[model samples]
Structure formats: structure tokens, C-alpha cells
Target: MTIRTTHVGSLPRSQEVVDFIFARERGEDYDADGFDAAMARAVAETVRKQVEAGVDIVSDGETSKISYATYVKDRYTGFGGDSPRNAPADLKLFPSFLKRIADSGGTPQYARPMCIGEVRSKGQGELEKDISNLKTAMAEHGRQRGFMNAASPGVISLFLQNDYYRTREAYLAALADAMKAEYETIVASGLDLQLDCPDLALSRHMLFSELSDAEFVKIAASHVEALNHALSGIPAEKVRIHICWGNYEGPHVCDIPMAQMFDTLMSAKARYVLFETSNPRHGHEWTVFRDRKADIPDDKILVPGVVDTTTNFVEHPELIAQRLSRFAGIVGSDRVIAGSDCGFGTFAGFGAVDPDIAYAKLKAMAEGAAMLS
Candidate 1:
């Protein structure tokens, strides 16, 4: 079988979408319906571009979102006001590096929303809008398979500061309950539902490294529990969970090893797992699959990233094939798919690879999968 291609969501926003997000962030009010129309157009264009890139499974490019995890604030109640967004512990460790990021204008200065009360769906018709937009694009472009991103219960916990819930675990449970219908709605469409869970691995160094191994495991386990509960009745096979450390080009010395987090990764009900591979920090960690092949259940599939997202270089098709082929050798061709290490545009208005370069990279991934097959 040919290695299949997919991507982490949040593809690069167009100049229009980028400007809208910035203006909205700056308290500039524009015509509401006009904004929606522009976003829909962007989603349509991005889907068409992905088809051209030869992606087997595509997304709506998360064009309507401000950021992947933080977009929840707009769709859910209880998140209001502002709070200090803590820099990742790793980033904080080097004050000099933080200065460099600020000086370089590499990172955007956006407000971090805080949860100020009990949780509830915003009832704003947001999720419906997203699904409708993606489905419409797929129909127009004659594509069949696609996925829409949802913030995992864990990732929501990771980025949003909680001020109302009495306990952290309670906050997570509320978030899970609030988001359960979203999972159901997406899966009900019968397209794949991608639960983006960066907290499992990224949080280890970002916020949880101060935790002992036992403490980290406890928190990680809670996250998995919330996710499984939310995914109840949704077939695990239709779900793919994506994990990655920070998408920034920062030192990842504090990243948790794949082996250390394998158990937690397995705990989610999702049957297909997508995670980083080609980026420099965790690129060499593929041996974890070779060593613990049995840890992967027979029914599960691994979409190990074969291309890097945070760089400008376009990977050779043969290189992507070699990476996918390595995973196939350890598991089997049927169990492997190819993807990027992380999203090229993890956050709106922030991207490492140029947008054109990002598509070129996916084109390489598709060509490589052909070579491997």
C-alpha cells in the first residue's frame, strides 16, 4: 500500500485572514458576515491547494481559527478576559532566547484568554460553520477524505488559565463535557475527527517538567480519561490524535521522550496517532517504534511525520520515502502513513516555512509516498 499523506491542521492563513485576525485581536470591529465570507473563501482556496499538493487526507486549513488550541475560547463559554500566558518552561529557562524571539519578531504578541467561569458551549454555531465550510470545499474539489481539528481536553487545559473551577481536574472534566458534542458532530459526518493533543508531549517540558514523573503521569492520565469519555460512541478507528512539542524553532532539550509518553499516547481512544518525527529535536527518536513495536496495537496506525514543518527547505521525495519506509520496516506498510513533524502554520500569522514552501513540502511528501509504495 502507498503511504498515505495528511497534515496537522492550521495551514497558513492568507493575507486577508491574517489581517482580519490581527484587526480583531486589536479590537477593530468589522462587518461580521463579511468576515465569515472571507474565511469561507480562504478555506475553499486552501482545500483546493491541498488537493493540488496530493494530500490523501486534507483539512480546511483551520483558516477560521486564531490559534488551534485557543480558538476554543470563541466557541465555548467561561473563557473571557485576559491572563498572562506563561511561556513554556523551556523557553523561560533561557531569558536570552526569549529576548531573541521578541527581537526577531518571530513570535506574535497575542492575548492569552483566561477561563473566568463555569464552562459551556458558546452556542455560536461555530463548529457547524467549520464543518459546513470544509464539506463544501471537499465537494467542490472532488475530494473524499478530510479531517477537522478539535482541541483536546488536555491541550485546552494546557493553554488556558483556569480561574473558576475549584480544581484543575474539575476544570478539565468540564471542558471535556463542553466539547463532547463537538466530537460527536464531526464524527457524525463520517469524516475523520482529529483531536489535537499537544499537551501530552509538549506540556512535559512546557508546563509539567517541574512535575515528577509520577505527577506528570497522573496529569497525563487525567487528560486521556477526559478524551476517552468525550469520544464515547465515536468509533476509535475514525479518530486520529496528533501530538507534538512546540512548533517554534526553539531548543527542545526538555522535551519528553516518545518512550516515556508511549503509555499515555496509547491510552487515548483514538486508533490512529499522528506525531512529530522529521524535526531536528525528535527526528532521531524513531527507534522508539523499533524497540517497542508491540506496544502499538494491531489495529492502530502510525502517521509518523516524514517531513519537517519549521524549516524553509523542501524535502526530497526519496527522503520522505526513506522515513516512511523505516516505520514500515518496524511495523508494516499497512500500519504506516506519512505526515509533517508539526504544522507549518501552527498559529495564525506565525509560520516558519513560507506558505509556498509549505505546500511544496507536502507535494514532496506525496511524491515520496508514491516512491515508497
Candidate 2:
């Protein structure tokens, strides 16, 4: 098989591009139909770029969704007015976030349990239509394969609105049901589905911030069960689950090692697992593979990050090759596919690393795969 590469979820061409297009259309004060038409064109353009760049699996660029969590929140309905629309005080550096959102004309809304029937708004129910439209558009305008991104219920539920549910178990089960509609939508659309599940390992910080290590693990295990339950009927091979420690450019001191959560993650039903393995903070932990490969079933594929996403410096092809070789040495080359540590522009509003540099990194990734060949 030809060596393949894919992103975990959001790319640099994420909501930033959406917001940009939205601004341009609103500037003209275009009506709803005109606005959607402009947005659809923008999405197709971004997808074309990813496909042209040699990405084997292309995404809609997730231009429609804000963040993985926020997007899921928008589609469902349940909770109302639980708390003020403010960033957590502890996240001081993000103080201007709320103001920024307001400046962008975003409204503060209450979050809910994300259950079915409570709110029957079909956001992505048109997902198949969107994919079909993109396929036809791409075939006419460009050429490529496509995939859709869905949030894992475990990850979605773990990032909660305060006191939403009496018990975590109840919240998780509800999230699973609501998210199944999304999973089924993508599968039925006849496109490959990649589940964005950074919370599988990263939930410790977001969900269990107040708990002790032992307590957190106990809570996280239930989340694992919820994830497996949500994905119970999906064929593993058509699915790829992504797990990361969060995709921010920050001090990841609190990020837990996969060693601590590997068993829980592998238990989730996914034919392939996408994980962070590049970047100085995580690169050395490739040793985790040496220690844990025995537990990873042979039928499962491991798509390790060979390109670092936290910096602007382009990784040399040889370095990318070395990363691939390292993973191949342990996991078998046939089972390993190169990828990036995380999406380049996870936050649409903030511009840190230059977009041009992000493209350079993908170029390096493709070259690295070629070197391995």
C-alpha cells in the first residue's frame, strides 16, 4: 500500500477561513441564502487546497464548526443558562476570549446535556448532502477523496457545562446517544469518519481538574466505556479515532502521558488510532510504544505524528523520515502512517504560527513519506 498521511482534526484552514468569509459576506450585508452560498464556496476552496497538497483523506476543513467541542454544543440542545458567558478565571491568559468572541459578534449561549429529542435541530443531518455536494464539486473543480470529522461522545461529555448532570455516567450516556446521530450520518454519507477525541487522554485537565490522580482515573474509565458504547455498531476499519493532549500552543505541563491512559484509549472501538508523537515535549515518549506495543492489537493501525505542529520551523525531510523509521521499527511500517502532532490552527481567531509555515510542514510530511518509500 502507498504510505498515507492525514490530519487529526482541525487544520490551519479552520474557522479562521470561515470567519474571514463570513466577514466578507456580512460586509456586503448579504442575506441568509447569499451568505450560505458564499460560505459553501469557501469550504470547497479550502478542501481543494488540502486535496491538492497530496492529503490522502481530505476534510471540509471543519470550517463550519468553531472548535470540536463548541461545534458539537451548537448542534444539540438541553441545558439553558447554567453559568455566565465567561472564560474560566484560572485560564487568565485567555482573558480577552469572551470579549474577542463578542467583538466577532458572537452571542453567549447556555449549554445543554446534548441529548436526542430534547432538541431535534438537524445541523449535520445534512452532512451527507454536504459531502455529496463536496464530492461533486471536487470532481468538477478538482480531484480528491473526502472524510468527515465527528466528536466522540466521551470527549464531548467530558467537557461539560457546570453541574449539567447529576452524575457523570448520566451525562456520558446522553452524549453517546446524541453523538450517534452524527456518527451514523457520516457513515451513511459513505465517507470515512474520523472521531476527534483529544479528551480520551486529555480529559483529566478539562473534566477532572479538581480530582486527585486516582479519582480522575476512576472517572475517566467510565468515559472509556461510554465511548465504546457510542461506537458499538460501527465497523472499526471505516473509523479512525484521534487522541491528543490538547492542541494549544502553551505550556503542556499538566498534559498526562499516554502511558497513564493507554489501556483506556485502546479499549475504544477504532480501527486506527491517531496520536501526538512529534514536538519536543512528546517526541521522547515514543518509548511508550516500545513498552506498550504488545497491548496494541495487530489488527489496529497506529498513525503517529511525524510533523510537529507547535512551531513555525519546517521539519527537515530526514527528520520526518527518522520519525517514521522509528515508529516503523517498532510498530511495523505497514501499520504506521505519518501525521502531524495536532491541527495547526485549532483556534480560528488567534494567529500564532504563520499559515505559510503550516503548509511547509505538510510538504515536509509528504516528502518524509517519500523518503521512507
Candidate 3:
């Protein structure tokens, strides 16, 4: 069987698009019509780039979002006031390295709004625009398979702190209910809905840093339950979930291993599980699948990343093939898809990989998948 290629959403945005995103994020006045035009052009070009590079499934590059999780503030009404920046645990351990990142302008600056009032959808106007843009672009490129990313309720709670809800559970439930519409709308538009849930792994060493691994897994399971509730009637095959230890170049020593949380991650209703496998910190985790192959549900498919995202070096095609083969050896090749460790451009202006090099890596990933096929 032929292997397929895809990526975690959020490719690098053009400068014109970045300017408009920042303006809107700052509440600064800008020509609404102009912003729309820029986004349309950007999405079209991004889709073209992916298709030309041999990605079977593509995305809008998350051009419409500020950052994956923080974009929720625009769609929902309860977020207000800034949430303090919480550095990852591993980064915190090395203050000098963290300072170097700050000095080098590597840290992305954007609003992290707190949930200060009741969570409610403002409407689907922005989401509809995103769908329309992606559909039009895909048609232009003659590409059929695509996925749209939405921040998971737990990730929303993780980044956008809750000030109004009495407990974390209440906050997550409200968010899940509020976000259910967006989740359904994406699938209804015929695009696979990707629930970005870095909260499943990233949060352990950041949000719940003080808790033991077992305790954090319990919290993660609750998060999965909330995600499952939001995913209620959505077809499992139409949905995928992305789990990652934060997407940055860091020590990542504090990250919880996949073995500790694999069962809880599989508990989500999504049929496709996308996660990091290329980065040095987590690349050895193929062993986790080898040991726990029995735990994966029969219907689940694995989208192990064959290329790293937070580095400039474009992975060689043969190396990528080797990476894919490891996962294919554990799960059948029929159940595997090629993907990236995370987004090339997670934020509008922030990414470690250069734009041209990112696409080069994607091209290599495609060649690698072809080798497996």
C-alpha cells in the first residue's frame, strides 16, 4: 500500500499576513477587506506549496490563527485580561538558555487571555471564512484531502487560564460545549478535524508540573473525556488528535514519556493519532508502540512524524524512510501516515526552521513516503 504524507498545521505565514494578524490581535484598526484578501492569497499559496511538495493531505497553514490555542479568544467571548507567561519546566531549569532565547528574539509575543466570564461562541463567521478559504484553495490546487486544526478544550484551559470557573473541570466542560460547534462544522465541511491537544503531554511538565506522573495521567484522562464529549457525534474516521511535548528547541528533559500517557491519549475519540517521532527527545519512542501495540484500538491509525520541525537541517529521504519503517514495523504500513514533529510556524513570526528549508523538508518527507510505498 502507498503511504500518505501530511503535517501538523501552521506553516509559516507571509509577512503581509503576519502584519494583519498582529494588528487584529492588538485591537488595532485595519482594513477588514484587505485582511481577508491577504489571508485568501496566503492560504492559496500555502496549499499550492504543500501539493507541489507531495503532501497528500494539506492545511491552510493555520494562516488565520494567531497561535493555535490563543486564537480561541477571538471565536469565544469569555477571554479577557492577559495570562502570565509560563515557561516550560525544562526551559525554566536553565535560566541562561531561556535568557538566550529571549535575547535572540526566538520567543513569540502574543496575548494569552484569561477566561474571565462565561464561555460562549460569538458565532461562526471567522470559522466559516477559514473553511471557505481552504475549500477554494484546495479546489484551485486540485487537492482533495485536507485537515483543519482546532485547539482542544484542555489546551485552551492550559494556555488561557480560567479565572471565572470554580474548578478546572467546570472550565473544560464549558469550553468543550462552546467549541463543539467548531469541531462539527469542520467535519461537516468535508475536512478532517484535527484537535491540537499538546495539553496531553506538554502540560504535565508545565501546567501540572508539581504532580506525579500518575496524577497527571488522571488529569489527562479527564481531558480526553471532555474531548470525547465535544466529539460526540463526529465520525471517528473524520477526526484526528495531535499530541506533543511543546514544539520548541529546548532541553525537554521534563517531558513525560509516551509510555506513561499512551493509554490516556488513545482514550480520545479521534481515529488518527498524530505525534512527534523525529525530534531527538522523543525519536526513541517507537519502542513505546512496539511494547504497547496491543493497547491501540483496532480502528486507530498512527501518523508518526518522519521529519523534525524545529531545526534547519532538512531530513534526508532515506532517514525519513527509516523512521517510517520503524512505526510500520510495529503497526502495519496500511495504518501509518507520514507527518512532521509539529508545525513549521507555530506562531505567525516564530519558528526555528526557515521557510524554504521547511518546504524542502516536506519534499524530502514525500520522497521518503514514496520509498515506503
Which candidate's lDDT is highest?
Answer: 3
Q: lDDT tens string, model 2, 15-119?
A: 535565345423444355554565477567766666666666667666555556655555676644433232332233454764564586544232333332342
Compared with the true structure, what per-residue lDDT tens digits does model 3 show for residues 265-328?
A: 8889999999999999999999999899998888999999989998899999999999999889
Residue pairs with backbone overlap in model 2: 79-112
Estimate, for each residue in 1-373, the C-alpha lDDT of model 1 and write its tens digit. Answer: 7878888877999999888877877789887788889889998999999999999898988888888888888778888777665677778888899889989997766767788988898674878888889999999998899999899989988888788999888988899999999899898886789999988878887677779867887888889999999998899999999988888877887787888888888878988899888988898888998888888888889999888887898999998998898899988988888888878777888888999999999999999999976
Off by over 4 Å in 1: none
Q: lDDT of each structure?
A: 0.86, 0.67, 0.94
Worst 10 residues of 2 by lDDT: 82-91
Clash number for candidate 1: 0
Give the higher-TM-score candidate: 1 or 2.
1
Query: Best-fitting candidate, measured by TM-score?
Result: 3
Runs in model 3 deviating more than 4 A are: none
lDDT of 2 at 276: 88
Better of 1 and 3 by TM-score: 3
Candidate 1: global Cα-lDDT?
A: 0.86
Ranking by lDDT: 3, 1, 2
TM-score of 3: 0.99
